[model samples]
Target chain A: MKKKIVVCTDLGPALSLLTLRDDLDVVVWPHAVDTECPRAWLLENVQGASGLVVCFKERVDGEVIKAAGSGLRAVSTISVGYDHLDLPLLASRNVQVGYTPDVLTDAVADSAVMLALMASRRTNLTTSLVTSNAWPAFQWTPFALSAPQLSTTLFSPKRTVGFLGFGRIAQAVLRRLTLGFGVSDAIYTPRPEAPPQVMRDAELLRGLMPNLHSLRAVDMPTLAADSDFLFVLAPGGEATRHLIDESFLRRMKPTSVLVNNGRGSVVDSTALAKALKEGWIWGAGLDVVEEEPHVGVKHVLPAEQGVREKCVVVPHLGSATHETRAEMARLTVVNVLRGVDGEQMESGLDLGRWQ
Target chain B: MKKKIVVCTDLGPALSLLTLRDDLDVVVWPHAVDTECPRAWLLENVQGASGLVVCFKERVDGEVIKAAGSGLRAVSTISVGYDHLDLPLLASRNVQVGYTPDVLTDAVADSAVMLALMASRRTNLTTSLVTSNAWPAFQWTPFALSAPQLSTTLFSPKRTVGFLGFGRIAQAVLRRLTLGFGVSDAIYTPRPEAPPQVMRDAELLRGLMPNLHSLRAVDMPTLAADSDFLFVLAPGGEATRHLIDESFLRRMKPTSVLVNNGRGSVVDSTALAKALKEGWIWGAGLDVVEEEPHVGVKHVLPAEQGVREKCVVVPHLGSATHETRAEMARLTVVNVLRGVDGEQMESGLDLGRWQ
Candidate 1:
């Protein structure tokens, strides 16, 4: 009998892998159906599914797992973070879990650095001025909408880069920040007893950066106070919620810029809105927001509500590059295939469970 | 016994310097006077002026210089380029000349890099989408408005940076391009043998950049073909007028971005306007246009003109920073003071006859 796999959430790239396997019955969700399906309807329909390939939006919890029952051998998510999955319950049920990691490091890092540059340069403001026809007659003025002087050692002498969580993406961002932007002296909040590779990478970064003054791990307060620009690259969970709040933003210098390429929940959107409204910092560039597609309205809403000129919001494009997405999908398929074959999965989440 | 100085234009930064000496009599023109003041009117107004501080709009030719007579010791301009000043006539008259150089390097370089970054990143398009509220609700397709991948390496196994001119501003820009953006190789138009210090500085830059594949002199065609992005930084005069016209722009790859931080006349704005309209090149960022204050309409006019969307035109702000302007003003003042004292002026232009 063929093992039936039900791919959810518009299985375009991820389902391409199972197309060649004759022994596996792969049910690719039609695009129209995926777009129009209600959550309750989806739950009622996916009862007899043998496997589930999930995405960020579709939550897979105890209830959903219980519905899958005994035949559901494996569950795979097309993302690095498995936050939406109920890990404890999945482990208790002996359901194998697979995730795609390390594939999107370059793309996320590239976006983070791009955001940093965009924030510091005020590209959005100047571009808008010209596009909106607000720019008046060309008269040389002492102060105009201009990019911050990055060539001179203006920010170098007091350079300090901060990361909320020092993971793979954070490390990659650090490398670009140090090498590409002449930033040194990083401060990060590491998880308790961080992995040896993380420490080794930190040491390696320090060695590579000649002007690196300090790379010490610190608490949130120290990180907020010292950093010229902060990168939020931590996980999105209850423990790490609102890592950057009102007080933290207030502590940052008026000239500093904030970039959030990580999870939106890691930052308090209301606090950020207030900080930008009150001019707590220079500006902000956010690729991720609290409520994604809906939050974009905040950028266009009235300035009184604090979502006007200073905030530059993109629609959650942290890892949206063509090359990166292809790599991610390919890696995710490999992980799923490996899990089904009873071989060691490439990036299997070690939940300490046995089948 | 006091030396008299007549400012043809509105009393600019140089006027403050002339006023410092109690022995010098400074005559300021009426603030509302038009630039097309006749020579007869100037002669009648300021009969015995020893120095003339004129702006680009005020033409200073043989007639104007002769009207100032034997008492006219120096003609100082508070600008870097002297295209407006008749150099041959000034040299023949034995009048000392002063122009500011090396002072505006950082500011111009900053602007150059800013234009490069802005152009490559499609800042204008992206900013419009966000501020106009045309995005978010629109489902993002693969062909959405996106920035060119600047991270794409150009050279085989390395990347190359090219410049139209190898002057101080261009060198500073090259520094930022190579260091900040990790450009490896460099190609610049050949110039006369520079001083030992310049050669040593180039050597130091090469030493600092490990991936610097080659730094050679190249012709315009080679530069256009090989360079990922081309910077027009050559001097503006009869020689360099329309240096980058139709053929030059067409030679560049469709993906390449062009930046003009030098004189507007160095580029054929008509050709550039058309190139961008037809997608011959990706985009352009220009600080200087063929006509100042006139080109403001190019940015402000209706979208039917097509120039508004293709170009990011900043009001000529190559040297508008506080730090740089102050420094340039101080230097101009020092030059004026030295000329009045009959001493060797700092940064005095060698007009051949005067030398």
Candidate 2:
């Protein structure tokens, strides 16, 4: 009897992983199927499912675990965060959980930096004027939409950088910011008792940037007030729900830029919309939002209604690179195979009280 | 008695300068009306004229110089180049001449760098897709049209920068390119016997970039073949006409980018258009053209028709910055004043036979 597995969500590079195991009976669901299935469908479909590979959209909760019964031995996700999995139920069932992490740090960091530059420099706006064929007829004066001069000195004379959560992605973004964009001072909010790796990374980055100043931990108010550009890189969990609310945005400078490269649930979209319309910030570049993929015409609020006309929105693509995605798929497959073989998994999530 | 001045070619800035000297009487022509003006009009306009302010657009040939009659002592131009002025005729007539220079360097350098980055990174193309709503419907794919990954050190293993001419503006642009873009090697075309100041500047720059490989002089073909990006900054004169024709462009790699900040005549536009259309090179960014402000649908050739579609073209705004333009205007005023007072001019053009 071969081990059976069910793959859910849009399996991008993940599909390649399934081809590696010849002995496993792999069933791939390319579309997001609804949880409720006909009685005959469930009986025939998941009768021999020994493992499950899921994405953020699939709700693998208590009911799904009960449906798999005792045959399911492990569950793995193709994402860094495992919020989609119900840890309590999976632990009680003695099911191992694996995820992909740390592989996407550089790609996400690069995207964050690009967004910051595009927003601050008004690249999208000026390029639009020229490509739309409006430039030749439009009367252009000297001081029209122009790029802000970014000095190459380590210490930027004007702006400061702040990170909502001090994590691996945030640290990578800071390194690029200081070296490439000449940012100096940085303020971040860290979890209690900062990790040793965070301190070591900070020390190494400081050595590279001679003029780096004030890499201190701060509260939300201080971070909001000091940052000319704020990068949100914290994970989405109950503990950090709505970290950036209306009050936090109100304290930010009107000329500041806000970028979101992490889980969008951490920021209140309505509050950001209000801030942009009210002139509380210069502009924003968002790669992720609270509701994604389905961000249609409804998501695009009028400039006067809430979001500023200058705000540039991008669909979630922080890790959208050929090299990065292939690496992620390779690592995810290794984690799944290790869990199934009863070996210690590379990136297994802790079950804590549920165990 | 007051000194009389005749103004030609829109006496806006020149009229303002004349207002500073209350002892001088300024006369403006209603329509470049020198040819149409009767002898009575000339007698009335030039009863005591001793100075003339002319623009490049106006014809100030030998005939016009004699028409101004014997009283004219000096002729000043608001422009930097004096191709329109009959320099030999003025020298024979013993008429002192003045023009503006060294003031528009910073603005031109800024535009040059902007074009370099835009062309190299495909900013114009990507930006057009985003703003025109031509970006495909949002899908979480591994590859998307996003800003190029600039922070990664992998692509630029050993970056090299090259300049065709090492003039004042080119040197300034070199400073920004090396510092901001992390370029190492800097090769430039050599002048006859490098001046001590030029050697000293090169040494100082080498110190700034520890990884700088060499700053040696090279031929045109070698410069194009070896450089990742090339900057054209040579003067536009008969001696250097069409210096970067088809053969030079053919030597460049497909990945290399070409930027033209010098006079348009220095580059053969027809050759560049063909190069872009045939994909001989990646892309080009041009601020100056052979017949600028006159390029339109009819001027484009069928084979070279796709050049504008692939290239990023800007109206001649190389020296249109607010700060640089103000400085140029002020320097032009000073040049005019010096010519009238018979004092040494700060930046007089060297109109010798060799120059």
Candidate 3:
């Protein structure tokens, strides 16, 4: 009998995996919409499955792992984030975990720069002025809708940028800033528990951000105080949650611009909203929020209402590009296929920490 | 007696031009509001002025030139575009014209990238979904708002960029594309009325866009056919009016992105609106429009209504950054001061063509 593989979503690339292997029986959620499969349906159908493909919308917790039994050899998700999975539980059960990374780096980096420019230039406010038919009410002044320039030009000198997490995506964004805008200085916080590749990654970062006259990893306090454009690229979890809370925001330069391309949990939205309203920082651009899809009984939440003018909030679209999505889907299929065959997965995680 | 100079707008940098010289008497329009100085007030106040500093809002016609008499040795505008000034009349009367250029290149280039990303990523539509509380109605599908990536990633190779007028600002934009996004090929339209400096400029362009495997000058038709990102950076005036009309847009690839950081008149807004509506091209980002400050009795013009989703329109805010505005103001002062003293101006135009 063929091994059963269940996919929680019917995305094109995910669905295509159903036809990839004749030896595997693939079951996909019936819904055609862009939504998460029902938890009850997934639990009921995932029984006796050897492989599973899921996204952020589904939680692959201990219950889901237990439901798959000892026959579940591998699980691959179509996302850079694996927060929904219980790595320790999967590790103990000897089920290899795989994820899609590096593929979406360029798309996410593009979005980081876009959000930074939008926040700094007040594109949201000014665009609203045009779209809301309020352009006539506001006369053109030298500083009417003016916000800070993202990069150096003839008159303005290069600015110092900071990063909370200096990873591949962060380095990609730094490249755009230096080569595009002539940005020259940078400050970042070194990861407390960095992997053995820190030294090599540091060297690689210098090569990528060539225009930087200074690139130093400092403490969090100094990083907040000095950076003109502060980017949060840290991973989300309990340890890093609310890393950019009120105190950190208060310590930042008044003229500074904050961009959060990392997990939404990294920033305290309430504090950020307050900071923007009280003019603690110039502006902010966010791809994620603490309580997103922020849809409650009323649909959209009121958390972002007061500070909408000073913020450029997009619906968690860091990797929402056609090329990036396709690549992610391809990697996901490859990982699942390899794992089910008991071969090494292409981008499998080393779950040794859990062991 | 000290030479009298009148500044039509009381903006900080323009007003500060008055204090730049002790030998000049400076008069400013007294309204504290952001609107332009009343035409009658400017006419009455401009009389007997030996030098004038004006913005785009005020028309510096033959009437104003006659009111100032022949003693008006210099007419310096704070803006790069001198369309408001009657160039032929000024040149006929031997009046030297000085305007600020190169100072705001970074700000404008920054905006060009901002708009391109906004339009290509469908950020405007996505952002509005969040702001208007309509996100709940839309499910988070894998390809709901997916558009083409602006930069080269692992999945998508480098894109070919085109330029309608490859001048200083366009070159600056190319720097961002090459260095920032890793864009590889570029095609431009060489000015038919070529100056001697075109050869040197071409060489310099090659040096700036080093990542490009192919960089060549092509005819308008070929440029339209080849480019994935078409930039309109030509100067605005009668010679280049409506250059990106129906035919040009029709020739462009449906996946192509059109960015205009140059002039309002260079593109026909109606044609662009139609093109966006019918899916002739992918999207457009315009910092300037044909009838800017596109205001109406109802505020937003009907021409821009149908295609708002595919078009990212910013008010003429290319040089609206604080640093750039200040620099342009200072340069305007220097130009006017030098022209008034019968010395060559820093960025004085060669009015010889009009003469």
Task: Candidate 3: list runs displaced more than 4 Å.
Answer: A11-20, A136-138, A192-210, A295-306, B11-14, B136-138, B191-210, B295-306
* Candidate with best lDDT: 3
Work out the TM-score per prediction.
0.74, 0.63, 0.92
lDDT of 2 by residue, B1-355 (tens): 7777766534334357777789877776655422222334444564445676655555567667777777666777656778877888877766667776776675576667667655654545544334444444433333333332222233234556678778888876766555444456677775545554566667757655653545666777788888877888887877668888999889887767788888778888888888877877767777766665455444342113466545666655676543444445555555656666767555665556532
Q: Name the DockQ score for candidate 2.
A: 0.12
Looking at model 2, residue B21 earns an lDDT score of 88
Which of 1 and 2 is ahead in TM-score? 1
Docking quality of model 1: it rates as incorrect
Candidates, DockQ: 0.18, 0.12, 0.54
Order of candidate numbers by lDDT, starting with the best: 3, 1, 2
What lDDT is reached at residue B44 by model 3? 93
Model 2, global lDDT: 0.64
Best by the DockQ measure: 3
lDDT of 3: 0.81
Pick out the ten consecutive residues of candidate 1 chain B with the lowest summed lDDT.
Answer: B149-158
Instruction: Report the lDDT tens digits of candidate 3 across residue range B1-355.
Output: 9998887754564555567679989887776237667789878988888888787777999899988887888998878878899999999988899898788888888999898898898777778778777755666556668888889865687788999888778888888998789888888987788655557657765776566667788889999899889989888889899988999989988888898888879988778878888888888888877766664334332235557777887777877887788777777888888888899999999999989
Residue B39, model 2, lDDT: 35
* Worst 10-residue lDDT window, candidate 2 chain B: B146-155
Determine the TM-score of chain B of model 2.
0.83
DockQ rank order:
3, 1, 2
Q: Give the TM-score of candidate 3.
A: 0.92
